[model samples]
Target: MPELPEVEVVRAGLAPAVTGATVISAEVRDPRALKRHLPLGADGLPGDDGLGGHGVRLPFEAGVARAADFERRVTGLVLDAPRRRGKFMWIPVERGAGDESQPGSVPIPLVERGARDESKPDQLALLAHLGMSGQMLLRAHDAPDDRHVRIRLWIEHPAHGELRLDFADQRLFGSLALDRLLPAPDGIDLIPGQALHIARDPLDPAFDDAGFLLALRRRGVGVKKLLLDQTLVSGVGNIYADEALWRARIHPETPGTAIGPRKARELLSALRDVFTQALAEGGTSFDAQYVNVNGQAGYFAHSLNAYGRQGAPCPRCGRPIVRESFMNRGSHFCPKCQQLR
Candidate 1:
């Protein structure tokens, strides 16, 4: 359940550790960890590279080399960078698919940071959305279980040499996206919704404004559901959504379309405010469940406006914060402030 800010923290934790290293080994660990990846035994090894006709790319050759290239070429490598676009991360593929016939999902290719773009087949991009309960981390293999570790990466570099990275989640609902990451036919292109189809971005300082209003202009979905939709805005999860709505003095059950611009803008501003505040509060821990990649429970839960604070008093109005089930999701709101008119 790690959202944008939490994910950004993970990315920051990794830059120093694995950014410049070669991926000596990459293991999925849990087959269900990856959506498109075929099931595997305990270690979650890649199944016969779907392209048996052609030889398979060895782990280190393809993996480590690729990781090095990614650090070299790709700028702004961060957890916030690889985000969900309607349930998947849109990674830019360097080349075309490996097989082309039964093209497996490899969004970002190994040669991302390298200067090798002779043909499409030579490189490719991968899109992976760490499903729920799926967490990602970067640390020395000796690093103790700071949190739930799912995937592990053994990275080697000439400068830093080596380290083991881990991605873990207890519920295991997190996912990863691997689009045919390589860029497509020049002039030939993917449909509009192919990449992250973000609606309103409260985070973007220069984020689109009119576009955000338009998305909220007409939609019968409840506010909670609307905010949860990555298409509407990438990265807002249950925690931030609840907090933002509560801050806007809006009820979670209020229908999206019924909201006016004033309410929407307040809600938007609250989104940024809540994320900033939550990142400060340790990002809302569910239980002993979602500790950071470092295995520390998020400090954000203490500052929560609505989530996990059932029957708690609303800080702003002193009214009791209410919790109810909607769309089968438990939502928290303040009755006095967020009236359902």
Candidate 2:
């Protein structure tokens, strides 16, 4: 699965290309997942250019020359830009990182209301969540369809003009949403600079030391399982959870509620370091699916401390990193380094 870092890369790559353009057309091979993403009644989409009408609006030569090519292509899924919520990628009304109200709290302007007129709307946010096996790629305007392309879009850009695109998902768990309503999860903040819901990034200044200790000490679940809870902290996926716990020198199964405040800081710091490093590597890829926007493997895999390095040597104590099952998922850690409390 593409994590926050990998998806951010894709979004960064796509932002300039998709923003300001109207959806020329959109085609969904998997309508079931598409419905989950962009519910019909919600209608958060841009002014529909009726997929067929776009062809006529194009230059005579451009339209006719591409008639055969555009025949079956879904008209327009104009991407006005996209946003992310923990793991859920969405399109909001404005462009840029958007106005940050406070940490984990950003106003998501959706739905045409008195607040935002439909005629002068800045852009309709194209929210997407690339689940475990999903990705969005920018291809040539007339690029041939690849084998994994489940969702396709023909976007008109400012500089590049018309560019055909694909949102490929092997697992079909990822989704797309044309939201008219920016539904926020209860209790989770969306401020751009402040903490995200599930993610208390190590880099943030508000990395609640006291709160961290309290959160962990309150939960009896294994540290690994507790890390996976988005409600507790946003964006700490399985890979990150495993890595952070390993770095903290605590077994993945050590109950979070049992860890002390001093150790809690270590755990939190390690989480920040792991995610910050992985984001720079463009996110990790142990499986065949997770490649960056440029289709390159991440650099973090070569330096993994314990997530997938099961039987491999622990980078720290030179002992073997052990792997086992916890919470129905694989748990890896350095046995010698992480003593049981």
Which candidate comes out best when scored by TM-score?
A: 2
> What count of clashes does model 1 give?
56
lDDT of 2 by residue, 77-119 (tens): 3445655545656544343322243244323334455565555
**After superposition, candidate 2 runs with Cα above 4 Å error:** 41-78, 93-124, 181-213
User: What digit string (tens of lDDT, one per residue) describes model 1 on residues 1-341?
Assistant: 66766655554454555434544445554433443432221232223333211133235433433333333322222221232333344333332123223224333333323464635433223344444455555566576764555555565644566666565767656533233343322223331123425433466454566776678768887788888887667678777888888888888878888899888888888888997777676666676655555656677877777887778788997888888887677888898988888
lDDT of each: 0.56, 0.62
- Per-residue lDDT for 317 in model 1? 78
Off by over 4 Å in 1: 38-128, 143-149, 176-179, 182-195, 198-201
Q: Give the TM-score of candidate 1.
A: 0.70
